[model samples]
Target: MTKSPYFPQPAVASNVAITTEAIDITTLFANAQHATAGGIVLFSGTVRNHHAGMAVAYLEYEAFEPLALKQMQLIVNEACSKWSLSHAHCTHRIGKLAIGDSAIVVITAHAHRSQAYEANQYIMDRVKAEVPIWKNEFFTDGSSAWGNNTPPINSK
Candidate 1:
């Protein structure tokens, strides 16, 4: 297996590609404060082999690094302000990935299920709609296409 890009620590609660070869979901939950929270929502987006019934073999992703990171930070900042969310973090995978690899993970903590669920949805939705990240899909037929768009900034 390949080592993770995140080192000593996973990112703080924010929207971005996050990993903790040392810090993972369990670690996040452990670090999360146990308040009067009644619910927690976690969302994970993974690589699948089929899209629109076409067999996908793999995928390669690239990003306008500086801008993409900025947008991710923005997403988190927005979320922190929009709800009673206690803690939220978003992590996405970069570089080439095979089928079944995890592409993203979003976690939210709230005192109520509604807030957690809604915030989780908003985080993922906004991440896809605003982040300057692009994916090049590799098909079984030896073909590729830019996902969303090239430069990724177009989607933003």
Candidate 2:
């Protein structure tokens, strides 16, 4: 079998990555720390026990690594350019994951809390909508389905 490109690796200063191993939030957060940053925000997306009222046993994530990583980097770069951020990073996990496992993480450090918070949210929203990652939801009843993981946007 061919080796997967999503192999685990030590967290570095990369802006984005798709890994098959568990996400190292500590390292990512540490790397996002900046002396000039007055506000730092981290967002971790975890696998929950339930989804859409169904009892989810577990989840499996797969990604088109080439495109996923590229898109992820673009998202992070966009956030950085949009805000006066001192640091920004994002990491996503693939492979089988149990409930409560961290699926993804985004960290942003800015001069103010508002920008940090908004940039972090913006990155997450773009990733969910544009990334080539797919999620499989396995239910307790032995049924499984490719999840519609994208959140609906409000049009007002």
Candidate 3:
């Protein structure tokens, strides 16, 4: 229930966070929604029980706070510029995360559903590709490895 100190003021039109706490989807959605926006797209990435045929036990995420925040802001701003967005908010959870735990969330508000959906996906894809955040996947078989950093083809 603790807010991440890494988060800038939530009142900012563009909000980003990298923290060890659980992501508050409600707060993020509220922040992104605006009276002028007709649509709000929310994407939540959860820690799954499996990955690539391996049984995942948990995941440990870490990030270079300053650079990660800078990159997140850049992604948010880029999406905002491309679409008629009222607000955009992204929050990533660091530290150990168990199955069903939300690892990240992206909320984008726009005048139409198409723009909101596109911008939300774009922000998440760019964050995975360009941000300094990293994650280690731990399997139930006691094996672990770094998570994939491959960017989606459409990210560009």
Top candidate when judged by lDDT against the true structure: 2
lDDT string for model 2 (59-86, tens) is 9999999999999988887788778577
Off by over 4 Å in 1: 1-15, 18-23, 149-156
Q: Candidate 1: TM-score?
A: 0.77
Each candidate structure's TM-score, on Cα atoms with residue i matched to residue i, is: 0.77, 0.86, 0.86
Tens-place lDDT per residue, model 1, 23-132, is 25566566544364567787878788976556899987777777877887787767766874667777766788888777777787777789779988998999888887
TM-score of 2: 0.86
Worst 10 residues of 1 by lDDT: 3-12
| CA lDDT for candidate 2 | 0.84
Off by over 4 Å in 2: 1-14, 149-156
* Per-candidate clashes, comma-separated: 1, 0, 0
Please give me the total number of clashing residue pairs in predicted model 1.
1
- Pairs of colliding residues, candidate 1: 17-92
**Candidate 3 to truth, TM:** 0.86
lDDT digits (tens) for residues 1-156 of candidate 3: 886543322234688888898888887777775766778999999988877777999999999999999999988988887785777889999999999999999998877789889989999989988999888989999988886655334422
What count of clashes does model 2 give? 0
Using lDDT, rank the candidates from best to worst.
2, 3, 1
